[model samples]
Target: MCLQIRDIKSKVIYCSAVLLAVMLGLGTRAYGDQLPHFVSVHFGDAIWAGMIYLAFRVLLTRHPLWLSLVLSLCFSFGIEFSQLYQADWIIHVRSTTAGGLVLGQGFLWIDLVRYTAGILFCYVIDQILQY
Candidate 1:
């Protein structure tokens, strides 16, 4: 049972990674041409979901679940807010086809809501997979 649980958890992590890649990739494709806010919302949720799966894999052994969750939340929010730096290098990257789509321009409150939605989706998915 333990091994099975671990395997399922690993699968969840793998799925999350794939989802993140797809989300970011799609975001990149849709970035410059007036995409909808839901695209950003999906991106934000993907971030939190990916982080939660990653945190479970990396920190579950050494930390409590709540701690890991808090850490994941912090990681998600930090990355979102950090984009405000608007560094020249970042701008240069964002100018590129790939960068412009994934690295969002300015912070939006809706993104925060997206992050929360993503975290909730993460838990829901994890629970479904755990069984």
Candidate 2:
């Protein structure tokens, strides 16, 4: 029963993360520079969502730890690359500091490390919580 509940929660987390990713993509374009603050908020929210997804994989399921980290890292990096869409509004948003820092200017190898670090952080937190 516990495993079943955990599986359901994991599915919900994954779906929510996907929906949030889509919304964030559209929102960054929609708000543009007119709402830089939300850009920061959404970026942070993305990071937290990524971390939560990692935690769900590591703590709530029987998945391999390294695989979970890799998957999360790839997901983040994929989203970063996906920002290259030629939407004028997206370009304008990318011009803002918030966008540049969050969405990134282009591909940076460090982002993979950042995702790994986030996953590791979530893994550690989950382990500590379990203790």
Off by over 4 Å in 1: 1-68
Give the range of the ten consecutive residues with the poorest summed lDDT in model 1.
57-66
Error of 1 at 25 (Å): 6.7
Model 1 RMSD, rounded to 1 decimal:
4.9
Q: Give each prediction's root-mean-square deviation over alpha carbons.
A: 4.9, 7.6
The TM-score measured for candidate 2 stands at 0.43
**Each candidate's lDDT (Cα)?**
0.61, 0.60
Best candidate (score: lDDT) = 1
Compute the lDDT for candidate 1.
Answer: 0.61
1-131 per-residue lDDT for model 1 (tens digits): 99768767665765666566556646645582565765643663555445554555454633444554566667667766867878899878877866644555667667666766666666566557657
Q: TM-scores for all candidates? A: 0.57, 0.43
